[model samples]
Target chain A: METLLSPVVLFFLLGAMATLIRSDLAIPETIGKAMSLYLMAAIGLKGGVEVSQAGFTPDLVLAALAGLALSFLLPVPVFFLLRSIGRLDGTNAAAVAAHYGSVSVVTFVTGVEVLTGRGMAPAGYMVAVLALMETPAIISGLLLASRSGGQALQARGKLLHETLANGSVVLLVGSFLIGLIAGKPGFEPIAPVFEGAFRGILCLFLLDMGLIAARRLRETRSLTPVLMVLAIVFALMNGLIGVLVGAGLGLDAGSVAALGVLAGSASYIAVPAAMRLALPQADPGLYLGMSLAVTFPFNILIGIPIYAAVAEMVAR
Target chain B: MTSRVANKTRLDILVDRPLLSVVTDILHDTRVTGHTVLPALEGEGAHGPWYEDQISGSQRKVMVICVAEPDTADRVLTLLQPLLDSHGIVVMTSQVGVVRGSKFA
Candidate 1:
């Protein structure tokens, strides 16, 4: 109950309600983009600082590899299931597959906040893990789509370019490297700006996100029951996989919950743009609504606690 | 003496998924050979910026560019009107010199 009433969750609910009520509220695009950059930089710098303190270990490497593997493999089952249940043709299933396979940075960031609020902190290297997990699922999703019916976009080279150069990937990886090089002393100068403003900015971004989600939900008339069930199941399975992997890696409860959030959250920013250019035939509403409207809210509001409890049990 | 040569007709169409095949079939039925479909990134219509990531099997806008004889364009537009009644499409015609009149018509 206390967790549910936290400022972060409350602000998110406020935003969601504001948007649903058709309030004239909005976060400026420029500010939103800047907030995104700030969050990435802050996470990277903090992670770098932690890495400096702890030193790089094999466990870090293993966790990263596991994250990559989950990102690559999770979508295959999702694609197949979507095919059977939704009766989605091959191309559409593959496009949707890519979405589930990828991690949502925003959700991961929210998890970090939830953990931090509870006075629990995850290892900094998780930032790099988050960065690494972004692209593999995309590749796998495209591959699955192509193999299913060979209707994959012919602009392979362009699609590769878009995936690699997507804004989120560049900002995330770049910030991680900056933190790696800058270390603690370097991060100190920018800490006041990046660290201090994070929560307020997150509130703003969540508000916009809420608006987008509400707008997406308006199109729910088109969603079938099968797709809805598939989305919920996939979200749950995704969270479960993250818990198992994080536990196997010997992560603590908070860290494990954060990881679960990462795995369960689908990419709305990066994957949607890539899909637009690559899989134009696939329905956007299905993928976007499932990720944004269904999975995102569920993770933020409910999945976090469930995962947190599961993490505690496993860690014990 | 040069009589007024028939103008070239341009057809632009934005359609959802299920209707894409039908639109293409219309073109095929008309024997209009060459057309290009461009992907729509974001836009506002009856629904706000149609987020492609939201709806199931929903349609994204595709810009289909076709150049044909005025008569053929007229026929195609006439055929497409009913289809576009429920959806969205734009049609326009302009006078232009065709390098090969026979090939175009």
Candidate 2:
């Protein structure tokens, strides 16, 4: 309940409600995009700075590999469920699967805020894990999609280019590197933009995200009841898997919670760009609706707190 | 005084921005000489109303316009048919008059 009332989450709820009520409120496109970029850079810089402070550790390596494993493997079960239960075709199933396997950055930021509020901040190096987890799911999704046996698989070269050059990936990894190099003294000059204003920008960004997701919910036609149920189920299962992996790797309680949130959240930004290029036939309404509308809200409202509780229990 | 008018096909495609490259590739492969792409501000469709002002770029649309010779337009359409079928895109073509058909060619 406290999590839901946080200013950022409340702003998100307000945006969703405004859209639901047909209010005329809206943010400009460029500003919203800029806000997203700001959030990414801030998180990356913070992570790099934290890693610098903590020094290199074996645990970071294990956490990273765990992230990679989760990213690559999570989609297999999702693809099968979508095919066997949801009765979706191979292409659509794969597209939606990719979304589940990848992480949502905004959700990650939200988890950090929520946990920090509770006096349990995750390790900064987990930001690197977040970046690492973005692309493997795309590869896993494409490989699964190829089994359907068509020209869709022929774009392997192009898909590789798109995945590597994706704006989110480039910006995130680049910013992290800059943070790593600059360390504390280097980050000092830009702290105001990247640090002081992070929460305010996050509120703005989430508000816009709320509007987008709610509007999409209104327009979504392809998310059938079975798929809807699966969205929630998949999130819970994936989040639990993430928690186990994090614990197995000996992560701290906060880090474990962060991992769970990363695993539980679905990609709405990076994966969709790749899917549109590689799986054009897949219905946007199905994947976008499931990820942005169903899974995203579920994670924010319920999954975060549940994961945090689980992490606390396991750590004790 | 009269102005010269030559027949040309105008192709208009409203598609997601990220896939604009794929659409443009099809046009280039079909031998189109020139095209224009405009950012879509907002609109309604099977997925309801959407605007460019969202945090995620998935829902944003771009409008690509191409004026080309009839045969070139036909070829472009042929290549784009499968993509159009698969993606949530709107493609329309109409008979248009151009002052310089050679430019389009």
Candidate 3:
């Protein structure tokens, strides 16, 4: 209830409403990109600063391992589901599966905001986990696609570039390193920009997201009722699996929920680019429609709160 | 002014951001004198409406323009032919006059 009413989520709803009504509300493309970059850097720096203060811990290591494992393996089941239940072919199924397996930075950022507001802030090291979880799913998805000979975008040089050297990964990792090096004293000066203005910026970004998502849903011709149901199901099932894994690993309530959020979220940014490049034969309308239009909004409106509640229950 | 300009082939490509490199490499491989890449804002196609989505970049597109000799343009076309249907790449070639056709060659 709190999250749904919050200005961040409300702005998102407003954006969607504006688009749905054809009110011509739009955020410029460059501005939207800039906001996303800023959010990534802020998340990274804050995580790094917190980690620097807390230093290394066993839980952090465990979280990282679990995150990597989940990212690498989650796509397998998703591929099968997409193939059988979703009635998609090998290449398309593999493409969509990669998206479900990967984490959404925006979704994680929103989850952290809600969790923090609820007074259950996840450990800072989870940012590292967030970064780690971004790319390995691409490897899994590609392997699945290649079995069906969807290897158009399989040049290792290009794959490495897309995975490691993409703008988001670089900004997140670089900002984290800067924060780790600077520590508390170094962070004090930039606190106003990064810490003070964080929520407002997030609200603006989510507004753009809402606009993009709603507009996409309206424009897409590829999504069906069954596929839409599968999108929600993937989020819930994967989220539950994430919570279970996090709890088994002895993560805190916040971290466990954060894991659920990450697990539940689908990658619209990084994975789509990779899939488009690697699986050009795959339908962008299907993958993009599922991830950006359906799953993204669902996760924002319902999935986050559900994961938070589950984390609370499991933690107790 | 018309007579002052020499005859050349103008090649324009509407390409997704991811494959911009592949197209440009074809340009390089075909040895087009030079090409300019521009961001495409919003457009509709057989797929649907698309805009310059920088975040996901799947919907984003670029317009690559090159003025080249006819032979060079033909070579570029042949190289990119395989990707046209599969990649949704659209290439347009038109005959145009340039002030420096020598430069294009």
Q: Using lDDT, give the best candidate's number.
A: 3
Against the native chain B, each candidate's TM-score is: 0.74, 0.92, 0.94
lDDT of 1 by residue, B58-91 (tens): 4445667777877777788889886454434545
Candidate 1 clashes between residue pairs 3 or more apart in a chain or in different chains:
A284-B52, A284-B53, A284-B54, A285-B54, A285-B55, A286-B54, A286-B55, A288-B53
Candidate 3 clashing pairs, residues 3+ apart or interchain:
none
CA RMSD of all predictions: 6.6, 1.8, 1.2
What is the CAPRI rating of model 2's predicted complex? medium
Candidate 1 lDDT for residue B26: 78
Give the residue spans of candidate 3 off by over 4 A. B1-3
Model 1 misplaced stretches (Cα beyond 4 Å): B1-105
Ranking by lDDT: 3, 2, 1
Q: Name the weakest run of 10 consecutive residues (lDDT summed) in model 3 chain A.
A: A147-156
* lDDT for each candidate structure: 0.75, 0.88, 0.90
Q: Determine which window of 10 residues in candidate 1 chain A has minimal summed lDDT.
A: A150-159
Q: After superposition, how far is residue B62 of candidate 3 from its true place, in Å?
A: 0.6
* Model 2 lDDT per residue over A1-316, tens place: 9998999899999989999999999887788888999999999999998888888888789889999999999999999999999999898899999999999999999999999998889999899999999999999998898886534563667778989998898888988888988899999999998999999999998899888888888778888889999999988989988987898778999999999999999999999878878887787778989999999988988999998989888853
lDDT of 3 by residue, A1-316 (tens): 8999988889999999999999988888889999999999999999999999999999999999999999999999999898889999888999999999899999999999988999999999999999988999998998888876655554568767888887788888899888889998999999999999999999999999999999999989999898999999999999989998999888999999999999999999988888777778788889889988998999999999999998888864
